[model samples]
Target: MTRITMREAISQAMWEEMERDPDVFILGEEVGVWGGSYAVTKGFYDHFGEKRVRDTPISESTIVGAAIGSALTGLRPIAEIMTINFAFSAMDHIVNQAAKLHYMFGGQLILPLVIRTVGGGGRQLGATHSQTPDAIFAHFPGLKVVAPGTPEDAKGLLKSAIRSNDPIFFIEHATLYQTRAEVPDGDYITPIGKSKVHREGRDVTIVTYSKMLETSSKAAEQLSGMGIEAEIIDLRTLRPLDMEPVLESFRKTNRAVIVEEGWRSYGVGAEVTARIYEEAFDYVDAPIQRVAQKEVPLPYNRTLEQLALPQVEDVVQAVKEVL
Candidate 1:
């Protein structure tokens, strides 16, 4: 295993997959010439050439639509939407077409399509550009939604999504590109719908994913100083959410604090909390607490934006509340 940044891990996954399968190609705004908005596809243009790393106009609908068309013709296409906020423009193609094509067509039309986009509110991208609407996309049945927290999961999960025969909405956190972690050596692939335990503890269960995983891990360290051991469950895949790990951890800890970068109401935390209560209510020692962003449009001001988003202190406080 080698340590690498989340950006490098993601880029490496796409690079390796494209090298292995000629059918796997990428299309998006600025993906070819600009090397992608977040630089995740840096140097892909020169490496893969125009045909494979084709860049399109600044139109989310066109980009996603073209990807669906190519996927129908037996080409596995990775469609980048630049940012999650812009995904609303292509909702029809994403939710209606790409997601339901295989199922609606009686499994004859296999869409090995991956819709790659970035989310989270950091760096003051404003309310419009900065949003974590992961739960909204995950609500749909046919689409597989995945958001990885660590570099290892990012590389492995992306490889799996590219190879899967279903449509996947891969959400990357905008602020986690530079975060580094140990990733396996070549040809590694993590299953799409499995949640993993990042840290083992008996005091409390802290569940999170994407950028919030980093925040919760920091909070766990601080909680440890206070003589509290927190077990963190990273929900890498949202749609086919593997709740077994979460439920098992909760049973052992008897308490939980669900943390997310999105709003608390009707968010990931809400869903997870509901499932825990439904399945593991007997193990509940305290009312589950949720640490999430303030219900408001993220501000352009850096200070206000940070305040609106969930913080490490927030997670710590939420964990304490549960205890």
Candidate 2:
């Protein structure tokens, strides 16, 4: 095992996948010459050449459409959209085409495409580039949504998404790119539709993904010091969610708190809370609590933005309320 940053792990995954499968290629703006906006694809253009690591115009819709077209014809394409907020421009292709192609064709076509993008706010990127769209894609029937928190999960989940037969919307946290963790040397893949218990406890269950997972973990640590043990469950894959671990945790703890960086209304946490209530309501000893961002346009001020988003303290308070 070796320690590496999330950004390096992601790049390594792409490089290894490209080396192993000739069908796997990357396409997006600044992906080649610029080495990707976050430098995740740094040096990839030279390594893979322009044929495989091709760069395109600044058009999200066209990029997604081309990826879908190539995927239908047997080429596994990884489409980088730069940011989740920009993906709104290409919703038609991502929602209607890339997602529904297989089911629409009655399983005739295998859309093995991975849509990679950075999401969440921590760098003060303003409102335009900082929205978390995991819930949006999760709501759709045919899309596989993944939000990995740690460097290991980022690498393993990306590899799995690239190999899967369905289209995967792989959401990465912008702030976690530089976070380092130990990763396995050999090729390995973390299965989709699986949840991992990040930190186990018996007092309360905190369900979250992506950046919120880090927040929840920190909150759990703080809660531990206060005699309130909280278990953290990382929902690696949002779509086709593996609820077994969540239900199991809820059964043991009988209290729950869902943490998400997105807005509260209709967010991924809402879905999780609803699912828990429906499946394990009788087992729950208290009402499920949801910790999420404020329902207002993200402010430009750094302090205001931080206030608007869910913090570690917010998660702790929510857990206490539920307990």
Candidate 3:
């Protein structure tokens, strides 16, 4: 086992996949010569050469569009948009074309495209650059949404996403890139729709993904001292959601508090609450609670921005409420 940062694990996954499969290639702005905006692909340009690790113009729509076209023509392309906020410009290609191509053609074409981008707000990028838009892609039918919280999952899920036969929207938290964790040295693929129980407990169950998972885990630790045992479930994949584990956890704990960095209204937490109510309402001991970011444009001020997002205190308060 090797300890590596989430960014390094992701880079290793991409590099290994490109080496193992000739069909796998990557394209994005600053990806070739610049080595990506966050330096995730720092040495990829020299290792893979310009053809496979091609760079694109400052156009997110064109980048995604070209990847979709390449996938349709039998090439596995990992298209990286600079940020999730910029993906709005390419929603037509992602939602309309890449998502519906196989279904509209009656399963005639297999779109094995992986669209990877950074999301969430911790670096004070303001409203334009920091938005967790995974819910937007989860709302679509044919797209697979994934947000890995650990270095191992980051590496494992990227490998799976690249090999999947469907279009995948892989969202990475901008703040989690440098976070380090141990990753195994082997060929491992975490199934897309599976949820992992990060920390098991009996008093309450806290469901979250991406950066929120870390926050919730910290809250859970603090809660543990107060005699509140909280189970933290990391929903690795948003779409094709594996609700069985969630329902089962709710059944065991009889309480739930969902944590998300996105806005509260109609966010991923809302979906999880609805699903829990629909399937395990009778089993729940209390109303499902959600700890989400306040509903407003992410402020540019550092203090306000930190307050606007969900924090360990917010999660601890919500868990206390449910308990």
Assess candidate 2 and give its TM-score to the true structure. Answer: 0.99
RMSD in order of candidates? 0.8, 0.8, 0.7
lDDT of 1 at 23: 95
Cα lDDT, all candidates: 0.94, 0.92, 0.93
Per-residue lDDT of model 2, residues 1-323, tens digit only = 99999999999999999999999999998999899999999999999999898899989999999999999899999999999999999999999998898998899988889999989886787878778767988989899999999999999999999998889999999999988989999899999889999998999999999999889989988999999889899999999899999999999999999999999899988999999989998997998999999988787789999999999999999998997
Compose the digit string of candidate 1's lDDT tens values, residues 73-180.
Answer: 989999999999999999999999987888888989888899999998888878898999999999999999999999999999999999998899999998899998
Candidate 2, residue 22: lDDT: 99
Model 2 Cα RMSD, 1 decimal: 0.8
Worst window of 10 by summed lDDT in candidate 3: 125-134
- Kindly report which residue stretches of model 3 are placed more than 4 angstroms away from their true locations once superposed: none
Clash pairs (backbone) in predicted model 3: none
True-vs-predicted CA distance for residue 243, candidate 2, Å: 0.6
**Per-residue lDDT tens digits of candidate 3, residues 1-323?**
99999999999999989999999999998999999999989999999899999999988889999999999899999999989999999999999898999999899988999999999987888888878878888999999999999999999999999999999999999999989999998788788999989999999999999999889989988999999889999999999898888888999999999999999999999999999999988998988899999988898899999999999999999988888
Off by over 4 Å in 2: none
Clashes of each: 0, 0, 0
Better of 2 and 3 by lDDT: 3
RMSD of 1: 0.8
